[model samples]
Every structure is written in structure tokens, then in C-alpha cells.
Target: MTTRTIALVFHRLRPNAIALARDVAAWAQQSGCKVVCDESDVDAIAQGGHSHLTASSSFRDADLLVSVGGDGTMLRAVHSLNGTLVPVMGVNVGLLGYLTNVEPEMALGALDQWLRGTEGTSFHYDDRMMLRVSIQNGSTKQSWLALNEVVLEKQQSGHTVRLGVDIDGTHFVTYSADGLIIATPTGSTAYALSARGPVLSPRLNALLMTPVSPHMMFDRSLVLDPREEVIVEVMGQRPVEIAIDGVAVHTLLAGDRVSVLAATERARLLRFNDNRFHQILRSKFGLADR
Candidate 1:
């Protein structure tokens, strides 16, 4: 059999995350598998006393990518993969890890099941939809992949930005609001939820568009088909900020436009169980049985 390559991605600032990575690295090495990590994480891994593992700038070829932090680290790992289909296994070391499927103590056992095959275990792959966002600003054009939601919000405080909405090449409506969110079904439980957007099942292939604090009367969120393309253009003098997965990336001026669509590529998550979405949700929010 060929030696498998496992890539470890972790939260550098979290001691528990680093410790988990070190343990996994040691186990992978002993199991005759190659262990790798992002080149930027080399120093941190070394400080954690696991310098023998390989450092890779890209994880496109990795058989599996292990995320040793919370949902944020898992998102970062997915971003680092850059649309590669490498399956990610998230071990939660942070609080409210909605994206993580396993805890630190059970991480190694989960890896064992994955490596040894799924014949006797409940191992499986959970595919989640993602969004592709493109921006056109005069002569500059850029695009990004978002596992969560894409946000176009006001750059300055106490100012509402004007944005024109279009769907499938047709003008829809214009709104003056604090911001707009274009979220995948997987993201409906994230930032969109806090904004009063309805929760969507992760298995659905749809988009959730919600406007934050809209000054207009039509403040309800819209559930759209994944095949439909939604565009938002800046219509006011004040510049707007574009954020992907909650990180502000660019500033859009008046007349600039952004297009959002379901990505051709999906995020593959490694799973040891099935149909736990509702259970996890209830546990995360401490919902009452009554």
C-alpha cells in the first residue's frame, strides 16, 4: 500500500490546539504516514516540539487535512486548501465549535477509523455547499471562495450604505442598510442567524440573502435558488467593505458590483456519524426539552 499524507492545520495561538497537533503528528509518523503542515505554521509547530513533520505551502495533494482548533481554524484550513477536495476532520479545541465533528480526546480514534477504512466504523464524508463571490471595481477584478457568508457592509460607523440588488441579470431592488449578507445554506446558522436570517438545513443547495438593519420596510430575508446569480452594486457615495468568511478584504466604491453564486467546488468534511445536525444545534444552544 502507498503511504498516505496527512496535513495538520491548527490554531497557532491556542496551546491545546498545538498540543493536539503534536499528538496527531507523532501518531501519524509512527503509523508510517507522512505528516505535513502549512509553511506558515512551521515555527509554531516547532515550538510545540514537532519540527520533524514536513512543512507544505499547499495541501492540495494531502489525503486528509486535520483541523485542530475550532470552526474558525477549520474555515482557515478549507481556505488554505484553495478548493481542493481534500477531506477535513475538525477536532474542536475552542468553544461553540459548530463546524467541528469531534472532540480532542476522540480525535486519534477518529483518525484511526479513517485510515483503517470504514468497514466497521461509521465513517463517512459530509459535503457542504460553498459560495463563490466575484467583485468588479472599475479595472480591478477579484474573486474569493466562502464557506460561510459574504458580507458587504458600511465602512464607516453610523452610516448606512445604499446597494442595488439584481437577480439573474435583472434589477430587483435597492436598499439602504447597514450591510447585506449572502450566505450558503451551511452559513445560515452562522452570521446570518445572528442577523435574524432563517436557519437552513446544511443539506440544502440554496442561498440566504439577508439585509442588516435595513432602513427600508422590506427587511425580511430571501431564500434563493442556488442556480440563480445574485449581484449587489454600490449605489451611494460612501465606500462599502467586502468581507469573505468575516474577514474584510476590499473596499468597494460607488458603481462597483459583486456577484455571488454557488461554487462548483464543495467543502468535504470527514464524519464518523450521520444526521447529527439537529442534535448539535440543540446542544450548542442549550435548548430546553420542554
Candidate 2:
């Protein structure tokens, strides 16, 4: 296996993550590997006399990025690595590290194994879909890439979000709900799960649409082939909020239409060869072993 330059990416200065970052950095240096850290991490580790870089510079030349945080931090790191095919490995720090596998204490061991090209060689790599969100009349949306779901929510007080769901210009549902969620199978475990949508296996090739607090009784979740194009129009209140992966992209007016679908580009995440999706599910949801 070829040895690649690895960057140790951590969350913004949190006490818990600091220790893990220190350990990972120390190990990287001792192993004669290059360690890349953010501005704050660089400051913290400067006391230990270890050299590091800002998040901006970390990904510029590194082959791989090791993320130290929960799923949120991992997503942040992935977003920062936009357009680059750098593989990311998440180390679970905070709660709900669904995207992350290795814990703090186990991070060093995992890294050692990865460096030796034995830990994650057998792990399956999954390509995730990204959504491109465009507001009818605004600058490019800031949060166009979502690892989980794209949400169209109501922003005005006491008003509902009336949207017409269309697939390839064909009408699907006209919903009066607090918001609507368009998610992918990889995002099935995220907000889509909380909205009572089906948990699609990560390997499935489909998209999920779930209504959030819909006033109409006929509104139900719809599963469509990955090729279908989803369009949502803001129809009710004067202003509606559009959130992509938990970040607000823009507020739309009554006439604005938001279009979402699978992007040609894909986000690549590194996995431990020994990891299994079913095992993660059983452990996370407390399902009994069969």
C-alpha cells in the first residue's frame, strides 16, 4: 500500500477533543508522518512544540483527513474539503457519532493501523449524494451540499409552508406543512429518521421525501428512484426558510421555487474494513442481536 500524507482535523477548541488531537498529533510525529491541525489546535499544540496549520492549509496538500468530532464535525470537515476527493475518517467525540467509528482512546490505535495499511484496507468506501439548492433570485446558496437532508421550512409566524412537490415538472403533492425533507439513503439515519421516514440501507439507490407536521392527512413520505428531479415551490407565506444540512441557505418569497436532486459529484468517506452497517444499527438503536 502507498503511504499518503494524513492531516489530523479536529473540532474548534473543545476540552474533550483537545486531548484526542494531542494524542493523534504526537503519534503522527513519532511515526515520521505529517500532522495538519487548525489555527486553534496549532496554538494548543505549540506549547508542546509541535507544528501544525490552519484548516484552510491542512487539506491543500494532504492525501487524507482524519476528523475528530461527532457527525456534525465530520460533515463540517467534509464540506471544507469540497471538490477535493480526500477521504475522511471520523473519530466519534460528541454524541451521535453515526458517521464516526473510532473513539478518542481508540483513535491512535486506528490511525496506527491505517498507517500500516491494515486497519481500513478491507473497509468499504461509500459515495454520498449532494443536493444543489438554488433560490430563484439570490447569490449562490451557501449551504448547497448536504450530507443528510434539504429542508424547506416556514419562517413567518403563525403561517404554514405551502409547497408544490414536483418531480421532473410533474406534480406529486401539494403540502401544507411546517417543512419538507428530501433525503438520501445515506442520510436515512439523520433528520429523516426523526421525521418518521423509512430507514433505507446505505447501499440503496433512492431518495426519500418526508413531510414535517403536514396539516393535510393525505400527505405521506414518498420514495423515488434516484434519477427523479425534486422541485419545491414556496406558495403560502411571504417568506420561507430553506435549510440544507442544517444550514440556512436563504429565505424564499411566495413565487420562489427550490429545486433539489442528486448531484453528479459525490463525497467519499473512508471506512474501517471491519465495520458493518447492520452492526452499527443494532448498536445505535439498541436492536437485539440475531
Candidate 3:
């Protein structure tokens, strides 16, 4: 029999999550399928006597990678995959289950369907767009990926930031606000939504420029075509912190320019026929129809 392979990633490997991973692993192994996980997760699981897992250093060639956590875990899994385009399945253990496919109780069944190829036949995939951010500080340039959004915020507390925003090399606006958020369509419901940015369809190939608590009149979010690259320059001799996907990664000194563009690759997300984006929004956020 041919050995099918599946990779597992965990959020924190709590008992419940560990049990789910083990259950999924055991089931896959029953049919001579290969179960692998990154060394980090393997070490975590080894402490609990589930060390029969293959310690993989990468997600390349994974038949399917399961993330038994929340949206953050899903994002991390995708980031680790690093443009490999591997299909990711998420089990929700966080507050917002936006990126997760199923709950912990449903994880085993979900994996069973995929492994058997019968119940999983109808499951589809959505290629969610991601952002490629490049920051230039003098001759040094650093690039990063953000599955959600990229924010340029002031380093000093209680002090606002000034960013000169441009689109496709044309001057647009200078934002006098707490910070600025450049969000992908998949991120519309995240930080952007709370800052009054309009919600975009998940399938839309677009980006949003939303100012965070602007003191000037041009405060409305601007929706731009996916082809356009956004440029934000740190102004006013003040340094700003750069946040990618909610974590502060670096601080941009004055005279730095950050460019954000749609990545050539997209995140392949696993979605079952039973799961729908609209339904999740209503269930998670209590969005009732009038």
C-alpha cells in the first residue's frame, strides 16, 4: 500500500489538542500513512509519550498540514510553509476561529475525511492573498510576509505618527494618525474592521489603506487595485514601529520607505463544503440580518 503523508502543527499542544493530534496520527498510521511534524512540535509531543512522529524540518511535499490551533496558528503554519503553497487545515482553539476550519471535537473526523478521500472529495481550497512587505533603511533592505496586515505605528506612546502615503509612485496623502494599516482582503475583518475600514470580500484581489485614528480630514479607507504597490515613508524625523501580522517586528528610523505589494504566491486554505465564509461571520460575530 502506498504511504500517504500528513504534517501536523500545534498551537500549544494542550492535552485536548495533543489528544486530537494523536488521534489523527494514529488513524492515519492505521492505513500505513506517514505522520510527520516539525521538530519543535515533535519535541513538544515527545514529552507526552507520543514520540512516534517523524521529525520534519519543513512542510515541503506535505500531502496536508494540519494546524490544531486558532487563526494565529494557521497563519504561523502558512508562514513556515513560506510560499510552498501547501494546503493548510485549521482546528479552532482560539477566540476568533476565522482561519480555522473545524473545532477540536471535529478534528478527527475532518482528518478522516481527507485521509479516506471519500468525504473529503468535495472539500475545496481558497487561495487567499498575502502581502510582501519590503522595508528600505538606507542601503539595507529587509523583506517579510504578512498574511493579515502590515502596520506602521509610532514608537513613542501617546504620540502620533506621520507617514507620507503613496500609491504606485504617486503621492496620495500624508497621514497624521496613531498609525496606518495596509490590509489584505482576507484581513478586512481583522484589525482593519475595528478601525472602520470597509469589509472586503475574501475573494477580492484588493488592498486597503486605513488610517488609525487620524487627526486630519482624509480619514476614510482607500481601496486600491491589487496591481498597485503602496509606499509609506516615515516622516517628521520620528521613528515608527513596523508590525506584521500583529507582532512588532522592527522599528523604522526616519528616512525609511516601506513598500507593500501582493505576493506572487497565495496561501492555499482548505475549506469543506459544509463551511462557508458568510456563515462563519454570522456565527462568530453575531451578525444578524435585518
Candidate achieving the largest TM-score? 1
Q: What's the CA error at residue 44 for candidate 1, in Å? A: 1.9
- Give per-residue CA lDDT, model 3, range 5-62, as digits (tens): 8888887746777767777777777767788998777766666566568998888888
Candidate 3, residue 252: lDDT: 86
TM for candidate 3 is 0.93
Off by over 4 Å in 2: 1-3, 45-48, 52-60, 118-124, 138-143
TM-score of each: 0.97, 0.89, 0.93
**Candidate number of the best lDDT:** 1
RMSD of each: 1.3, 2.6, 1.9
Total clashes in model 3, counting residue pairs 3 or more apart in sequence or in different chains: 0
- List the candidate numbers ranked by TM-score, top first: 1, 3, 2
Q: State the lDDT of candidate 1 residue by residue for 201-272, as single tens digits.
A: 899999999999999989999999999999999999999999999888999999998999999999999988
Q: Per-residue lDDT for 187-278 in model 2, tens only? A: 88888888888888877777899998889987678988888889888776567888877878788888788878776667778776555778
**Candidate 1 overall lDDT versus native:** 0.91
Q: Count the backbone clashes (under 3 Å) in each candidate.
A: 0, 2, 0
